[model samples]
Target: MPTVALIDYGSGNLRSAAKAVERAAADAGLSMTVTVTADADVVRRADRVILPGVGAFADCGRGLSAVPGMLDALGEAVIRGGRPMLGICVGMQLMATIGREHGDHAGLGWIGGEVLKLTPADPALKIPHMGWNELEIVSDHPVLRNLPAGAHGYFVHSYHFVCANPAHTLARVEYGGPVTAAIGRDNLVGTQFHPEKSQETGLALITNFLTWNP
Candidate 1:
């Protein structure tokens, strides 16, 4: 069975995420063992890694950093080992070089970018870009396989990632403007929405991740 490490850094919707991944694996007919853990050893041995985060960027970054050897373990498994990894919502934002949520907070810097508050062109559009939005697939990636253009995903965030490399951007959504929805670089992928709460669209993405080789 393939092992998946759902890092428990005291943030993110842990239960929902685990359930989603497990279900995706089952739906895809892939035998996968999903472990929601903070253990560095477990993370190091994981075939696939998932980092999910909810709440403020600074708080999530601090919480992830609080874990002893957790970041190092992730680096070993994802960066060095070249294992496939996924980041969701604020988890994805944490992959940026820096986040300016409460203050100037550093991120994982896996993808060269900055997390900034979403500035909608229309004044009426709310701050927190909540509810369902259609995805505009910008690039082709294995994780996006079987997913249609304009697939709807659940989103609840006020900030967005501005990737330094435009080629890394996989998908975008229209709010008041083009808000980044997904990013990808080699084996790393991140989404600014909750796949667990995204219904069929989310399930397709989750399934793809489970079966994706890289």
Candidate 2:
């Protein structure tokens, strides 16, 4: 049985995310433990880690940093440890090198990118782009299985990740401008929107990640 650690930093909708993970695991017919903590050894020993966050990117980054050794634990698990890891919402943005929201700030740099505000080259589009949007899966990754090319998922964010390397981008959503919906490199996977807050397609995505062999 693989244990999935949901890092309980001070941010993120932890309860909702935990329930989503539990439900996803059950739907996949896989038994797993889902808990919130920042214990380094527990994170390293787990089969997977979920870095969930919400609110401002800078505050979220600071919260993660507040936890002693949390980043190093994640590094070990996702890099040297080879345990699968996922980042949700602002958590996903944290994986990038820089975020320009509320002021410029540093990120995890796991992926090369800058998190910038959703632009409106067209005045008709809304800021803080919210509600369900269509996802265009650009690759054949198993984590996206059963999801149509135009699957709709919930989104609520003002800033979006501009991936420096297009190869790392796995999915995209249009909000006046094309924004990265998800990005992945090896064992590290991230989503700019909250799959937990999304409905069926969101559930499917989480389930696939839990059961994914790669």
Candidate with best lDDT? 1
Model 2 stretches astray by more than 4 angstroms:
none
> Which residue window of length 10 is worst by lDDT in model 1?
141-150
Residue-by-residue lDDT tens digits, candidate 1, 104-131:
9999889999999999999999989999
Q: Write the per-residue lDDT of candidate 2 for residues 1-214, one digit (tens) a residue.
A: 7799999889989999999999999988888999888788788788989999889999999999988888888888888877788999999999999999989999999999999998957888887898998898887777777875467878888999989999888999877768899998888899887889888888989998997776
Give the winner by TM-score.
1
Q: Estimate each model's TM-score.
A: 0.98, 0.96
Q: List ranges where model 1 is wrong by over 4 Å.
A: none
